[model samples]
Target: MPSREVHTATITSDGTGFYITEPVFYAEPNYEKVNYNNYGMAFRIQAPPGAYSVYVKTTSDAADTIVSVSGMETSRLLRGGSWDAAKLVPKKYIATARGKEWTYTYVNGRDYLDIEIEPNKINTPVGVEEIVLQPIPPQQREDGSLPTIFILGDSTVKSYTFDETPMSGWGQVIDAMFNPDKVNVINYSMGGRSFKNAYTEGRFNDILMSGSIGDYVFIQFGHNDESTDEFRRFGRGSTESMYETYIKEIYLPAIRERGMIPVLITPMSRVRGNAAPGYVYTNSFINRKFPDIMKRSAEESGVTLIDLNSESVKFYNEIGVEATTAVVMSIEAGETPGKTNSGSYANGHPSKKIDGTHYKEALAKQFARIIVTELVKKVKAGDSTAAAIASYLKADVRVAALSGDWSKIFPEMAGDTTTGEGAYYRNQIEKLIQLGVMSKDPLGNFNPDEEMTVGEFIRCISKLMNLEKSTFADYPNGELSREIMGAILVDAYHAKFTSKPKYMTDYNGTAVVPGDPDYDPYMDPGSRGAMYYPLVSWQQLMDTAQIAPHLASKVKEAYELGLIRSEKGIARGQMVNGTELEPKVAVTREKAAKALYFMWVLQQAVKAENDVSSLK
Candidate 1:
């Protein structure tokens, strides 16, 4: 058998360090053709700090082998070879580093090794390793607070373990946008279960028992309830009748019994038919009965109704069939399975599959805003007279306008006003600027038409808002580099404004040869990725102004609310220009008009709700 030799070298700033490497086997052996082996070779090396070691461990497959290190030692071994078992071997080596340089060599066959060293004078883990598991405690629910929401549905509302990847149920996202301290949310949903099962199997009862006075319940079903297969189907009318039973027999009685409120939600529509343009009621036969029955039930029960199906349809229609499909589909092109890819359709269900019937976190958040808007409206007509419905409405409008962009909060500065700019966003920007939360640049130019640099854009908003800053002497120039905008970037990162990748180029230094053995082109700027940065950005600024962090807690609060994501698996610092924010993006005066007009409308809605409540 032919074999190859490999060698590796390392250098440390201090004289005390270690070096380790593995040998690469280039030849492919046909295990099936031959009785390859009953055993595999293993190598090990142990050394103290200021010493070096090298070894190789082979596996049947190269990918299965891993190189790892322990304190001041190194080793290599093969895994999954035709061999059934192998004895653990230990080897020790000693070496002297001239200055800070160390080298290692190995002969032939593929193998892996890991190296470890004593804590160098300069290197350390990034802070203490802490894993926070429990949900952050909700802020104080003072004497007066936003109405608590209880969500009850099926897989469409809550996902199954099988459906947890890539897409979380809409309920998860809905729970994120509100202040937990003010609005307590309890999502009681199970995947593959429907309204009938929920009530019969004790889920609904569980919610009722947990309910408190002044709380609100939002109920949506039909996805699983409408399933026609005998094995899974709950029967169409049966589902509707069960819905009625819950409203009259369960929901109403519980609410009235406990002085809580009920809000009926029509089942969100499902995406069906490949050739047809968009999502419709799952089957026309059942659709007519479900929606009408649910609507009537809500009316008869004197409960506020939110037509989620209708709203979803309208919103999808506005975005067009393809865009809507992209929004609903489970998998987008150029994505791997098991990884949550964008554009929805991973499974037949809404979240995992990216179909019209379900929503991804982003869209679920929007839907939640819609539901909250209606709920607030209803609350305004009751005893909560001081509660501003406008706040809810403004939140919806702002979220819709921002579409996840924080920078759009300042319309006068974002400059999205254009004849073609959608009225939705235009109005949001105008209101935000008017509210004095955002402003234009010093040049009297909002630069509404320009793509914002990471530094310029993050810093602009950071300065506008009084965010925290850090100074590090170890950073470039004995001070954290200003050009990199580390201060704002770090703050944004902490606040979840931007995401960094697992591996990112060291942009602070001059570019190195792409293929150099010593070159790690993908070095992350920080340990965490950008998706964790919750703060809004320029593209976000162009969309909605209100979702932008207005207070210090808003940043952390937004993170807890699930309003932001972090780049957990990717690399960072490769110049993420806001492709969505085109340069010279002229803002049409009409767009501005639409924004202001909507803000007025939202404000009026709030005022109206207040008035109604006062009358009560």
Candidate 2:
């Protein structure tokens, strides 16, 4: 294979070779200084098929430094001293400049060479001053001894780039589960590629041409295959029958032709509402039978099968919609950087809108753990193919210790066994606590009968939906009024999903304030204003100015999303011209839970609807 000259390289930000952090906040020139306490820096090195000696010069206030290339186990740790002593003893934290060298044979592709300074493992920062590369001799390179595991699937399994930081696929993180010295993982999965397009686009060919004889190929698809829409792959995606045929006939046979082992994995599930029952949430979606079809195909072909769909569903459902957002790419407004369908935030932080389809690094690692754990089980049951892969798994992954259920994973979410509540909204309150939205005081009392303050409600709702944490920093004291609560709920929903509510302004452009004709606060004739904005849209309540200016938009959105219903406590201020949103009436904790329940239900409904529409 051809090799490029090894030299002291300048780290570029945007090209084929560069250095970047995991969350990708910024890339420093030459990668000399790093501010984050993380194992996130990945530097790309261009190399050919040969063994090489890599020399890295670095100093740190941190206690240790670990460096490893792709397909290699990281075992060496360069020990240092604490930076804290520098305050009293000057130069105590100064970097001990030394060149540490690691020798490894070059792997295929320009993969990232990761330098991990164990995150939170050290309290101080680390700096890498230089990296020098030198090729040893052709004789030193390992000659196709280690078997490679090539991953093929959609966005859920593909490895992401620096720009796409924080978003990782299971294919990318699965490497961590394996003993790198035993196996090499090369992810060929691409975003939006179904069974048909993956073959058509020569992704499969890339694997066949590049991989050795005994390599393993993991095949997973179906997220985009069932689509009838022309937007994805210009309608080249498969139908149900087509998907089945491609898997059993074309995909399996082709892998066998290349003397490769084929492992089939069903597609994972999407995020749904807490209101959805386990059965309904797990099984309901466009082409929901895809998993079943995959199971049947695997049996007929006598291929090793991993049922990730069922496992992932159980995981998402147990966690609930609110908890699931952490793993998926559901970006809240101002969380990182604002992202809407139209454009990005001006400040330019990394953020995305409410994305249910893709997995963040957290979820990707979880799913990866689940997949490997299943393989470990198969090995124990005496499956030859699974044994081949499971043999290479890290010691911890060799055991089936990872649980798909959230409550088992997080004990606090299960709630205190000794305490209980007897309120009418007891179930709702319990669910909220389980979801980490609400908690008990020192006395173990939820105090559900008492009125919920505006500040309290804001914090609970924000935590429940994983909205921008600082969105409502102005959490005012005092009981949240019924109308204000409605506004807050709708506002949070919009901030999360980015769905704008419909509205219109009068042609006369009148600045309407509170206490007008229909909004007359004290029921006095003089309190009634001269002009009134007509309730043009039922989606838009007539007199929004009647509420506080800060809460006016949310109240309008509440009407638009149908979150606010006109009932006894929730009143229409006017008897004739328009509905009056009762702004002064306080909402108790139980009533707040009811409103929150409606909002949660709406979240799942919208997701399900979107899932169905995507199929068309």
Q: Who wins the TM-score comparison?
A: 2
User: Candidate 2's residue-wise lDDT over 417-451, tens digit each?
Assistant: 21222333443454466466666776656666678
lDDT of 2: 0.53
TM-scores of all predicted structures: 0.39, 0.43
The per-residue C-alpha lDDT of model 2 at residue 331 equals: 34
Candidate 1 similarity to native, TM-score: 0.39
RMSD of each: 23.8, 18.3
Per-model C-alpha lDDT, please?
Answer: 0.37, 0.53
Candidate 2: give the clashing pairs: 572-580, 573-580
RMSD of 1: 23.8
Question: Compared with the true structure, what per-residue lDDT tens digits does model 1 show for residues 1-616?
Answer: 1111222232212223222222222222442211111111222333211211343222112222222222111111221111000111111222223222332321101122233232221222111111111211112334665666777777667632211223346665565455565566666765666654554334554444445556666778767766543222122224455555545654466445544566678877665524245433333325436777778877776667777777776665555444444334343211111222221111122122334455443345446656655555555556242143224344644454335443332234333332222222332343334444334565533433343343333333333333432322212322211122223333444453243221122111232322347634244322212221212232242422333233224333332222222222221112121212121232233322222222122212111111010001
